[model samples]
Target: MNLKKIILSRTDAIGDVILTLPLTAYLKKVFPETEIIFLGKDYTKDIIENCPFVDSFISWDAIEKNAVSEFQKINADAILHIFPKSQIAKAASKAGIPIRVGTSHRAYHWNTCNRIISFSRKRSDMHEAQLNFQLLKGLDINYIPELEEFKDINLIEPKQELREDLKEILNNGKFNLILHPGSKGSAREWGVDRFAELIKLLPKSKIQIFITGTKKEGLLFRKDLVVPFPDVVDLTGLLSLKDLMLFIKNCDGIVAESTGPLHIGSVLGIHAIGIYPPIRPMHPGRWAPIGKKTKVFVKEKKCSDCRKSGRCKCMREIASIEVADYITAL
Candidate 1:
């Protein structure tokens, strides 16, 4: 196929978009001359902006808002649909992109695309990264090693002011330990009482603790506060996603619930300890950190709150001393 311009679409949340970045890196590395375009949501743009692989980026919703006019403007040779939807398929069809490739589920139709491949819905069986990798098969790109997939994208350094601010907080040359207590939804949190107890236990430790998350996480952060804990700092709702990355990279280790920051810490090669409940569907090989230094602390329970209910039972079982011990050992 003499494809010069390519549109890769996957308009999803932050973690979903991060997993798909390897796909972008793979495409760009193999076809260096190819003009790579990413079609995603607004927030996705921020997540992928630093990716050296993408030639140009566009938001699918922005195009949907002005379908006809936008379609005429983006004249591409092929469209790679990561998130296959009727609206996206319809727009790609109307744009008259010569080739179209995407998943067959959701909104399947003759008008959808000529190269539609079926995507599995089974949660436990498939890794999100591997699912995105499946799209490569359609483009004649063979399977590559997991670690080699990401072409070394340059590291984005945090702003000087932010770095200085963080440095001041760390008076001594102490190792920073980041704690992300709350996940995006209510289903993932390990609870505030447990975190508060943990903080109280780590007073004299050499580890400097820092907490961060979105504005919604402020409620949980306040609840997790201890009366007197030396070198404990809270920056919840203060940093941007990029700033969060810098903060994590600067930290010696990370202890977080299964969320975006955990994934970020894994990618940064920081020692990350993920706290998750032991459930049937949860597979370490699939969801656990790809880095060797990363460890997953799963508390096995009969119910395991994660199997049927999304709430984590194992996290509650893990004691404050256990978590503190793990960090000290690392």
Candidate 2:
């Protein structure tokens, strides 16, 4: 029970990593002296580093290259497989880190992990953040946090300063809103046309809009969304992850599907609005942003038709005007 150092392993995308941060806050509450080391992928390094709860970050790539040796170097008292990887589970066991926590569902965890918790993410109705708390049962920590408790966690604090050019782009008078139209094909998109419509609805004098995405996503929607709206700033492919975090911190709000920036905006205490489809597991009920100023837009009904398709008609059906109205109200 007197654990000094623990590794919270969630080598996943930005949003997933962001969701896992609240668990660190709770862990710190229980064991204030415990050194929290985050195990994440190279791309999500910035997200993990920004977390005030995490003491250090160890790249999953390093562990994958030399699992046992790398894990042994840390000398962690416990390792939680937040995102179960067979390689990590095996290595943690080999390294003899004492407590190894993972879900019982994964067949490999049975052999490698000593502390296995019974829970199914797909079947459970808990929010993604809440679901992560189930892993704590492995450590004999039974307290489950309510959703409201997450608001004051201060999960992500942007340490990076914005560049001169990026800093200048922020409109002090207007509501500086960011429109992230792509999810890297991770979630059901609200489509470029709807985003364009939303942009058009918001008055230029009142809302300074910025479009963010990868180079490929920008290229895909450039002619249709960017060129047509000359007033909107095209920051796609320009800002790095750290830069984006800094920029979001300065901005007033952000609107996107279930993606990294949306979660980042929420954690920063900005007006983070998420558009979601009413599909099982993917619905807002499961993956909504946990923030003081977060809002979700989704059709209040069950949807199974677009469960497999990324281009969800149900998501698109949530009118652009409705989103615009909500933003203006905020």
Candidate 3:
């Protein structure tokens, strides 16, 4: 296919958008002359624009306000819906894009999309990044890239400089680590008690720790986690998304659940240690950070008792001593 312009639509959360970045890298490799426009939410604009492979970014909000006009102005040859959105699919069809790619599972795609690829995200054993490549089948690209191939792909380039106050917090002599204890209800958390225990176990003299999250999360854990540890720096609610990315780039590593910042740390080639449950779909096997230095701590056994609840006893059971030892070794 001799395509000139392609819009990669993934209007989703941070981690989902991060995983979809590899698709742009693959697209660039196959179609060197083709322009890649990433259609994403406003919150993810920084991430998409910073990607070296992405040529431009279109705001999904704008598309929602005026789908046909917004898409018509793009004049794209194709649009791949990496994260399926019904309205976006309908808009792409209404705009008459030459090749509209989406999943066959979506009944709406039968009418809206010209090219539909058949696959089940929940049933597939592939990693999130690997599964993203399956959507490329719509473009006549049959390759499903291996997880190892992602190690070589340079996805994020943090352009913003770290703030002066944040820069001063970095210790050149020690490993500057970020401990994100909350997931904002996205993934099952590793529990504040466990994180507090992990902090106490770490060698404070050899490691500089910083706790990061939204202001709400900060207030929620401040009393139990931050107040107890006077040495730990509190950066909650202080960082914008761009600041967080730049900050993660400067840090040595991060420990969190399957969240955006963890993925950022991984893509930046830092030691990103993720804590996860053994539950299906949410397990590390499916959503693990894609980086050369990433590590995952999950229970060996599979149990779905907590599948319906937000809390996971299995994830909390991962010992603080084990995670501390790995960080210390790094």
For candidate 1, lDDT tens digit of each residue in 203-227? 5457788877777777646654623
Cand. 3 Cα-lDDT: 0.92
Q: Tell me the spans in candidate 1 whose CA falls farther than 4 Å from its real position.
A: 121-124, 147-163, 201-204, 226-230, 280-284, 299-309
lDDT of each: 0.69, 0.93, 0.92
Which ten-residue region of model 3 has the weakest summed lDDT?
Answer: 302-311
- What's the C-alpha lDDT at position 86 in model 2? 93
Specify the poorest-scoring 10-residue window by lDDT in model 1: 151-160
**What TM value does model 1 have?**
0.84
User: Could you tell which candidate, 1 or 2, scores higher by TM-score?
Assistant: 2
lDDT of 1: 0.69
Sequence-dependent TM-score of model 2: 0.98
Which pairs in model 3 have colliding backbones?
Answer: none
Tens-digit lDDT track of model 2 for 1-330:
999999999998999999999999989888999999999999999989989899999998866979899999999999999999999999999999999999999999999999999999998899999999998998988877899999988998867788999989899999999999999878889998999999989988899999999999999998878899889999999988999999999999999999999999999999999999989889998899999999999999987888655568899799999999999987
lDDT of 2: 0.93
For residue 270, what is the lDDT in candidate 1? 79
Pairing residues by index, what is the TM-score of model 3? 0.99
Cα RMSD to the true fold for all candidates: 3.2, 0.8, 0.8
